[model samples]
Target chain A: MPRYGIPEYRLPYEMLDRDIDVITSLGVKIETNTRVGSDISMDQLHTDYDAVVLAIGLHLGRSTRIPGAEHKQVCKAVDLLRNITDGDKFKLPKQAVVIGGGNVAMDIARSLARLQKQKFGGVKVTVTALEDRAHFLADPVEIKECSEEGIEIFDARGPQECIIEKGKLKGLRTWKVRSIFDEQGRFAPAYDESDELIHEGDMIIEAIGQMSDVSILGEQLTEDLEWNRGRIQVDDNGHTSVEWFWAAGDCVKGPDVVHAVADGHRVAGSIERWLVGRQK
Target chain B: MTEGHSSDYERLQSKKSLAEILEVAVEFERTARDFYTNLIPKVSKQIRYLVEELAEEEQHHFDLFSKLKSRPDIEQLIQAMVDTPASDQRFSDAIHLPDLGEKPDDQAVLQFALGREHAAMEQYRSLAESTEEGPIKELFLFLANEETLHKNQLEKLYYETIHSGGV
Candidate 1:
């Protein structure tokens, strides 16, 4: 959805229904409305099948430790996009401040701009990011088109806090970002504290990035699984530490559809090879 | 990067200079129109008319963009309108351009053209969202509506050429 320019609308009803029809005709039973860690459990899945592969993607958005970040209007980009895609009719805010400089930021900014235009007759979205424009995380096309779409893009700006007065969001207090990387090229950001800018808005959205959800593994199983750098450690073939359990997709890699598809194929191949060897 | 380009882009985002936005918009419109003019020769006569029609509509949009850019006092209304919200119903998705090699078939050419018009329509609607009310926004709406018409027409042509044309 973010890579391809298509926004808001998915496939026309007939086409989507047809696609679902075809997928279902393949004799593969599919279930929607069920979620792991709650509606379903990994233990149940493993007991029902000989081998289990965990492909649970990262759905949680990273939050900042900034002051007043817990305001009701402060939200994640994914949550806002999901709400819009889910056809939620919301009263558009007078101003929306989006924190982050990635494609997800652009997605939220642009989508909200459309809604604001329909509701108020003009766009009022300001996107503030840590990296400067030259080093922005979002695709250059997304940046340019978003600018052309009238979304305010602020590069090299770091969010200090979500400003609130009288229990209401008033603006986002930010500092000018001096450097996004350390001398060793780490992800540490250096900001100019003296240089501050307060972007007034009714809402603040964090689009910095996303993290995977691994709670479905449960306490015992999760503790037993070897992990690396906050992600499940998997071999080149996507095999987890546990012989019978494997991991793939964003839970193993990150948030990317193409990567998820490639991971799916690799794990499938590994499963096939293992099954054949066992039979022999 | 310019010394204050970042700050400028931020300030510019909420309220853009009317002429600058229109100028860029004109370039995009012209590019989309010229896209068809260049692709017609690569396609057979079976689809040339459809391409020509698309090109003409895009050219009309280009003319509209130019006209909107030239208006006096547009700058004054620009700040106000730009501050106001504008509606856009057009949608966009990723699309690939028509490849010149492989002696591409009519179906491929039609599909590419269909995607192009779809993108153009979506672009105009998006531009409308950024543009303020009055003539400029109206111009964007006009061009966007025009692109929608072109997209629908192209969709029909594609349906006939593909579904009815026996693949």
Candidate 2:
């Protein structure tokens, strides 16, 4: 996450490399460009090593499935962030509309705003979310910085459709959300049909959420494993159903740096205990 | 994974009656309660309470569905016309109880329960996503969110039970 998912501004690359240097200093082997389930099979790993830890996090960005969302201009925040980190070429939109009200959304918005500023000497980015300002899922600091960056914020707006003119992307059509949850506390968002607005932009970014790409586990391993929601099921100690295999980090739990680090410790402890028991 | 991402959103839509949906949901809860109750004997003494709590939570969900089924407002929605073969396939298909095998450890049992809770949450989420915005959608969304919260709670309890100083 620190390497590619997070922006350089938030987490400097030098600091990330230094932390990696410390881990490598301790004789830990780090491999790059070696894709698991492709370069090496899980069965081979089980035979070669006593344990296998799968910490493949949520790398795929989710789509809202609204009409016109399949357009090239309608990008996922996760993908955009990764592209920016990889130094890949991306067209900076003159006006962009971002959906979602989380830290990632803010990151994308602010990042794009900076890019636009550099390219055009101005920023025209709009962020719309289902939650009102009182209940934004984003950190207060992120929200504040977005305004400081001169990005527009529209709270409680539920995306209905992506506006496309001819073959090009236009903007997003959204309605004001009356309530995000029902009396029973469900995620069913009710919108005020009368209160609607079309935010004009050439690009729309869906920063709603992300999910782990489990296809890398291969078909057999996926079927053999237990899953919760869409994540591989693991015990409190991060042990998977398969005795030799274990999963932790964002693959088992959602995104959170502290939680991921805690999980790393938890899984390490479990592996240590197992190794000790094996020795005895 | 993200909470609402489903590839089969369109295919998951049911033509079954609202009453049928409630029936299947209630049955799901009942089966979950039974599953956890069955696990109680397999788990260790220290974590037996966890199984009991899980079973109780399922019962509470069942009660909520039952109450909703009896509500006067729900009757109108239940009778609304929608065409398709009626079957409890979705809920029934998702109901797979984990095999604890012989001499189950605390971690094994907790892992099994976590799997069940996650499956329950996923099923409800799919239902919520497939259905149009309405009371029924709200109902399924509510169930899904409840399962999510329950899953989070169970994760916390599992850590406290399994870890020494809390990772």
Best by lDDT: 2
What stretches of model 1 exceed 4 Å from their correct place?
A1-22, B1-167
Chain A TM-scores for all candidates read 0.90, 0.96
DockQ per model, Cα: 0.01, 0.04
* Candidate 1 residue-wise lDDT at A112: 89
lDDT of 2 by residue, B46-128 (tens): 34566778799889988988898988888878865343222335346756665678556555666666766777777778777
* Alpha-carbon RMSD to native, per candidate: 23.1, 13.0
Candidate 1 lDDT score relative to the true structure: 0.70
For residue A260, model 2's alpha carbon misses the true position, in angstroms, by: 1.0
Give the least accurate 10-residue stretch of model 1 chain B, judged by summed lDDT.
B84-93
- Report fnat for all candidates as fractions from 0 to 1: 0.00, 0.00
TM-scores of all candidate predictions against the true structure? 0.58, 0.65
Model 1 C-alpha lDDT per residue in residues A23-113, reported as the tens digit of each score? 7898857787798779978788878887888876656566654788888889877777767766776656799999887777887899889
| Backbone clashes in model 2, listed as residue pairs | none
- Model 2 docking grade: incorrect
